[model samples]
Each structure stands twice: as C-alpha cells, then as structure tokens.
Target: MFDKYLIDVATLRNTGPADAPTGFAFEAKLGYYRGLGLSMIEKLDVSIDGEQLPREAVRFDEGNGPLSLDEMETAYDRRWPFGTPATILIERPGGFPPGEHELSLLQQLRVSYLPFPSTNSDAKSVSFPG
Candidate 1:
C-alpha cells in the first residue's frame, strides 16, 4: 500500500537569533498489529516549492509495541535559530526563492503479515512575501 503526507507551512518557524537552516518538520502516525514487528523502513522524501529537498530522517520511539496501535505527532516547523528566514540556508538542491512554497513528505513502510495500509492528509501551500 501507499500513503501521502502533507506538511503545514504555517507551523514552520523562520525567526530566531542563531544561525540555523530553514526546513519543515511534522509528525507521522503508524498503526500496526501484534507480533508484526513492523517498523518504518525508509527516509522521508521532502519537496519544497515544487523542488525536491534533501532531508534527514529523525525517528522517535513512541513506545508502542507490536500489539498496540496509536498516533504519533512530530514537529514539522522550519526556522533559523540565528539568521533571518531569508538568509537561512537549505541543504537541498537549489533552495526556494523568496515567495510562496509548498512542502511535502513521503515514506514507505514494511509489514510482516498483512498488506500495508496507507492514508494521507490534504496538501498545504504557503506564501512568503518578498
């Protein structure tokens, strides 16, 4: 099965005093059956302003076991701890220009006994006035 996830740009942080990179973050929820021992098996695909961005996957253990199903929320906000939002650097190829941008997340999962089930939220787009 396949699933699609969208990130909200409003939640991204862009203002701060320290030099930091600009990027978006968000939480993903996964549900699994008992003894399936299924886990997230890949990194997230990130895209900004219609362009693909390089991203590092940060995984957190929610403590839910193989027999349990629950929802997990992750931070999807982007910000620069030291520099202005405009000056913040992005590791992805050809960073976005000063204007409206759209960010998205894509991932694949593995299940032991059952077919993978997937779902997605609506895509979100935001504008940054130059």
Candidate 2:
C-alpha cells in the first residue's frame, strides 16, 4: 500500500563531499504500515538501470548516522518509524551522471505476525542531480 511513496524523488541527489561526491542517495519510506527495527531488515537490494550494485556499496540512515548493510544486522536499537523516510545511499565513486535512470529498491522485512518476512519493492525513473 505504501509502495508509491517508497522513494521520494525530490531527495535524490549526489552525496558526500560537495567537491568530490562519493555516491548518490535518495530518501526511502517504509512500505509497511507499521515501523520495524533495523535488525528486522533481512534484505535490501539496489539496482540502477538494471545493474545491481554490490552488497557492500550500499548504506542506510534514518537520522541515526549511516550504517553499512552488515552493521544494520545488529542494530536492534535503531527503529525505522512509520512515515519517516530513510536515506539509502550508494557508493559510486563519482555519483551517477545527470540524467534520467531507473532506480529500484527491494526490501524484505521481518514482521511479528507473519510467518515469513514481507517483501516490498518499487522502481521509478528519476533524474540524478548534476
């Protein structure tokens, strides 16, 4: 139900030092109705224009500072509140060039009542900031 808002287009931009960006990022809202802790995130895969980024090249931050995918595994204290957008950053050395490209996010989250983790994903064509 919250898939449409998974990625906020306005927040998509290059990140890191202004003079030499190390990556690109966008704000991503949880697709679930309720919030979940960072530890409950079982999977988070990112791809741009059909090319999947390496597992170690992604990081997540919901205002608690940036954490690598591995660090998020034990971040039980960090909670991703409902309706709040987290920044999903990708390390691309110089960030993506300015233009329209397909950005995709796939996430698997463990929930209390469900026997299996819930999977949510969304993709959209967005223009990268110059």
Candidate 3:
C-alpha cells in the first residue's frame, strides 16, 4: 500500500537580507517495518513554484553520510535507521521572493518487502522571508 511514510516538510526558512541563504528543511521519520531488511531511498525531487531545482544542489543527510544529487545514483549506502529522523536541505541563492510559493517533493523509496519501489509526491504552500 502507498503512504506518506514519514516524508514531510518540517520547517521552512525564507530568504532575508542581501547575503542570506534561503532554503527548505525537511524531515523523514524512517522506521523498521516487519520483513523489510532495509529501506533504500534514491529518487528525490525538490521544486519551487513549479521550477525544478538541480539535484546536485540538494543535500541529503542520513547520519551515515551526506550525499548530494550528484551522488544519489551512486550512493548505495543511503539508508535510515528505525525511528530516526533524516534531514534534507535545498538551498537557493538570492532566496525566494517574499510571498506565497508552492513547495513540492517527490521521493522514490525501495524496500525488500515491496515488489517494486514506491513513490511519494507532495506539495504545500510556503512563505519566504521578506
């Protein structure tokens, strides 16, 4: 069955000042499931207002290691432990314009219990700092 599976946007920070960085911080509550040996997540897409950002600029941290979009495909050890929080960061230079914007994400996850990989995509509204 498909589900949100702990994928959620925990917090958002708007851009401020001239030299400040604007980005989105996300949290994934990965946990142990019956019969699942490990959870491997690779497909991660982050976009702002329909504009897709480069995966290379997205940062994914799973405590075991830090990986970017560039290494996502090659990184085989990207797994989260049970009941642990995984962090994902996407920073945009110049920051987002002050106002309401749509934040979207698509994640592809694999598990031993499932025959195929499961995908989760979600979007929500966010306001950047003025």
Candidate 4:
C-alpha cells in the first residue's frame, strides 16, 4: 500500500512456462488516490503460493532496476508517480503449477510529513474450484 492508499490487484496472469522464468503480471492501482510519488515505497515483499520471491524478481514498469526490500530509498525521481494501471512484473525461476495459488504483497510505505513510516499489507488467493 502507498500511505493510506491500497495497491490492489486487478488481474493476474502467468505468461511463461512453469519451469522457465515464470511469474504473474499483476495490474495494480492505488485505491482511492489518484497517484503517489515514486519514492513513497520504502520496502516491498512479494509471495506466491506461500513462497517468498526474492527482491530481485519484482520490477516496477517505470523503474530502471529491481526493488530491494532492505533498501531505505528509491533510485528514481519523485516526480514520477505510481497509481492505477500500473503493471508489476514478478518472476521466479521455477514457477507454480497450473492451478490455484495464493499471492500476497506487503509494502512498507513512507510519508513526507509523518514521523514514521507506515505499513500496508494485503493478501489474496486465486482459487479455481470444480
């Protein structure tokens, strides 16, 4: 989440082979807010099917390098904002089976006027039942 805003997942897709560099392309947005500054994300954690993906696997479409969960700051300019229609790419070496899975994202956010950072985490599972 970005401050009080929620980065929600609208769509999830597996566009690669199961054994290849496979992962989900999630289309997300900052709920209720128009947008957020680029540096607002202090740390981000991603997990698929309960397996935590490395920090190097997550990439924002507008950023040059991958995001680090331990990093204290962003490398891009603050002018670039993130909001709805943002596509986030998360890749793993060996992908999940062709079935239901749980996808979750925990984000530590930074606010300009706040004395301390905020925590915004969300989790949702994808289930297809017969």
Candidate 5:
C-alpha cells in the first residue's frame, strides 16, 4: 500500500570512488509507518534498467555498516527506525554511466501480527550523480 515511498529517488548515487565505483546506492524508506528490525524484511528484489539483480549482488546498510541480504535475515540487533531512510546498495563494477536508469524494488516485510508479509513495490527513473 505504501510502495511508492519505498525508495528515495533523489538520493540515488554511485557508491565508492567515482572512478572505480563498486556499485550504485540509494536511500530507501520502509513502507510501514513504524520501524521494525531488519529481520522483519523477508524479501528484497531489485532490478536496474530492466535487468534483475542477483540476490548476492545487493546489500543493505543503516549507516553503521553494510550487511548482505542474507545477513539481514538474522539482524535482530539492527533497527530501521521510522522516518529514517536506509541505504540500498547494488554491486556493479562501474555503476551507472552517468545517466538516468530505471530502478525498481519489491520488498516483502513481515508484520508480526499479520498472517502474511506486506508486499511493497517501487520503481523510478533516477539519475546517477554526475
């Protein structure tokens, strides 16, 4: 229901040094009104310019440090606070070539009281930092 706000399109950028970028990154917000532990996030599917990214190619970070998607499954110690954006990283050797690219994310978040996880989808055309 709150999928449109899942990604902060304005914060898209290449991560690591510009010349040797390790990947691209962008700020992401939770669809839920309140925050939950990283473990609550069940699935995160990302695609760039129409290509689906491998599960191993994406990472999540909340500023303190970066964690693999698998690691996040057990990251009970990590809290994604409400209204705060988390960084989503995609591993791409050169990142985007300074152009606008279609970025999309589909996430399944588990709400403890619900029988099924909440699914959120967001897509946008964002420019890489020049």
Candidate 6:
C-alpha cells in the first residue's frame, strides 16, 4: 500500500527596498509508501521565473544550514516514516525586478520497495509584485 504525504510552501519572502516583501504560505496533502528500515529518500525542487535556484539538503524543520543558496539541489535520507509533513521556505534574491514572478515548488518521494521514485507533484504557484 502507498503512504500519504504533503508538501507545503510555508513561507516566501522578498526583502528589498522600494519593493515590499511578498510572503506566501500554502500546504499540500498527498500519499506515498512507507519505506522499510530507517531511511527514506526525499528531494525538493525550487524555481523562480522558471529558473532553478541553488539549494542544499537540509532538514525542513530546521532552517537552511551552512550551505549557501548556490548549491543547486538538496537530497537526503531521512529516518522518518511516510505521511510526514515537511515545510519549505524559498527566499528570492534582492533586487528582483518590479513585476510578476512565477514561483514553483516541486517534490519527489521515494519508497524502499519501489524500483523507481514516484512522479513529481505540483502544489501551487505564487505571484509577487501584484
């Protein structure tokens, strides 16, 4: 049987002068399979204006660690079970042009028994400078 999970965009902030900081928060509810033993593979993808941002594999509950924003991708093997809630935050670089920008959050879940990882799920998008 497959397990249920969720990918939520807890918050988004744009800190710059002239342009007010835009914040967004949302949650995604879904399901997946419960893996065996003590490790589950998870991947998170963040993009802005269709361009991928640099991200490091860090605990969702814990803020971005020592890794810089140029790391590209973040992957990790967790000891948590399926259906766990993970929160993510995406911060835009300062000086973003005064216009609408598309922000997307993509997530992938993998189980131990499954040969290949599950399909990517699309949560929702937020527009800034509206």
Name the better of 2 and 5 by TM-score: 2
- Global lDDT for candidate 3? 0.62
Error (Å) of candidate 5 at residue 100 is: 3.4
Could you report the Cα RMSD, in angstroms, for every candidate shown?
11.3, 1.3, 4.0, 4.3, 1.6, 6.1
Give candidate 4's TM-score. 0.67
Residue 108 shift from truth in candidate 5, angstroms: 0.8
Enumerate clash totals for all models, in the order shown: 12, 0, 1, 0, 0, 7
lDDT of 2 by residue, 1-130 (tens): 8888888878888888888889999899998999999999988898989888998999999998999999999998999999998999999988866788888898899998999989999998987667
At residue 7, candidate 1 shows an lDDT of 42
Across residues 1-130, which tens digit of lDDT does each residue of candidate 3 receive? 2235555544554433456756556665543342122236656787888988887768777776667766655665455566566676777765555678887777676766789876767677766564
- lDDT string, candidate 5, 1-130, tens digits: 6788888888888878967988888899888888989999888888988888899998998877999989999999998887788999999888755777888999888999989888888998876655
- Superposed model 6: Cα runs more than 4 Å off: 1-10, 14-39, 57-59, 62-85, 95-99
Off by over 4 Å in 1: 1-6, 15-39, 55-97, 115-122
What's the ranking of the predictions by lDDT, best on top? 2, 5, 3, 4, 6, 1
Alpha-carbon TM-score of each model against the true structure:
0.43, 0.93, 0.67, 0.67, 0.89, 0.50
lDDT of residue 23 for candidate 6? 26
lDDT of 1 by residue, 59-86 (tens): 2222331111121122222211211111
Better of 1 and 6 by TM-score: 6
TM-score result, candidate 5: 0.89
Best by lDDT: 2
Candidate ordering by TM-score (highest first): 2, 5, 3, 4, 6, 1
* Residue 43 alpha-carbon offset, candidate 6, angstroms: 1.9
Q: List the residue pairs that clash in candidate 4.
A: none
For candidate 5, the lDDT comes to 0.86
Cα displacement (angstroms), candidate 1, residue 68, comes to: 25
